[model samples]
Target: MNYPFEKVADGAEETKLIAEEFAEELNGGDLVLFHGNLGSGKTFFVRSVCSALGIDGVTSPTFSLVNEYHGEKKVFHIDLYRIEKADEFENIGLYDYLSDEDAVKFVEWAELFPEQLKDYDFLITIEYIDDNKRKIKIERK
Candidate 1:
């Protein structure tokens, strides 16, 4: 599907501004799926969002798989980079995070489990254009 909202982030500052604006759309029960290639600034975007939400010390959940933060609203950050199958997702108890009605979810590598996206509200795609350039597309589904 073609996303209606597209923005070019010229650098980290621009990306942070964009992320701050995007975070304004979040509320409880919101799920955001982040799609991007490695080093494409997905984590950077997440950090910006968390910061805007009043959550501090945001980091990639690569090794831990999921990270939870409490701010104006609860935020759940899930990284599925290590998950290769549905069984792995189930084993990790991701459903608990996905079903939490009081938390906003930002899922990285969520494209791995398309079938479990019934509760998702947004899809964000970040594409690398150059060393300091990125194309970010936000779509509602």
Candidate 2:
């Protein structure tokens, strides 16, 4: 509910709650960057937010690179996990997705191309605390 929000989720339910609450603050044209290690729930958090936005069947775009969805709002889900070079960004038409002013864009592994992303609405970091617990932090900029 606030910028620089921080919480330690005891399990998946709590994390989903946090994602739903975070989704409330989102709007069209917003860009959200997710930072977390492998198996740290980044995709799950994105899925939760999309679910709160009236979208279903959300899944990771890791292999596909980008997945677009339409619900209450247009959503662009991108995963740069397998991208090896900055040039690959352009090759994947990532610029086109980023230029969509009427969509909410969520980027996973955004930390991999920091220089390519200069403007973002929210930056979220999820750190695994255990098999079931995670520390989630969100910052608005």
Model 2, position 69, has a per-residue lDDT of 100
Q: Relative to the unseen true structure, what is the C-alpha lDDT of residue 122 in candidate 2, on a scale of 0 to 100?
A: 94
TM-score of each: 0.95, 0.98
Overall lDDT per candidate, in order of appearance: 0.90, 0.95
Shift of residue 35 alpha carbon in model 2, Å: 0.6
Residue-level lDDT tens digits of model 1 in 1-141: 244679899999999998998888888989999989999999999999999999989999999999999999999999999988788767889988899999999999877788887667999999999999999999998
- What does candidate 2 score on TM? 0.98
Q: Give the alpha carbon lDDT tens digit for every residue of 1-141 in model 2.
A: 877999999999999999999889998999999999999999999999999999999988989899999999999999999999999878889999998999999999999999998899999999999999999999999
Note the residue pairs that clash in candidate 1. Answer: none
Residue 4's lDDT in candidate 2: 90
For candidate 1, the TM-score is 0.95
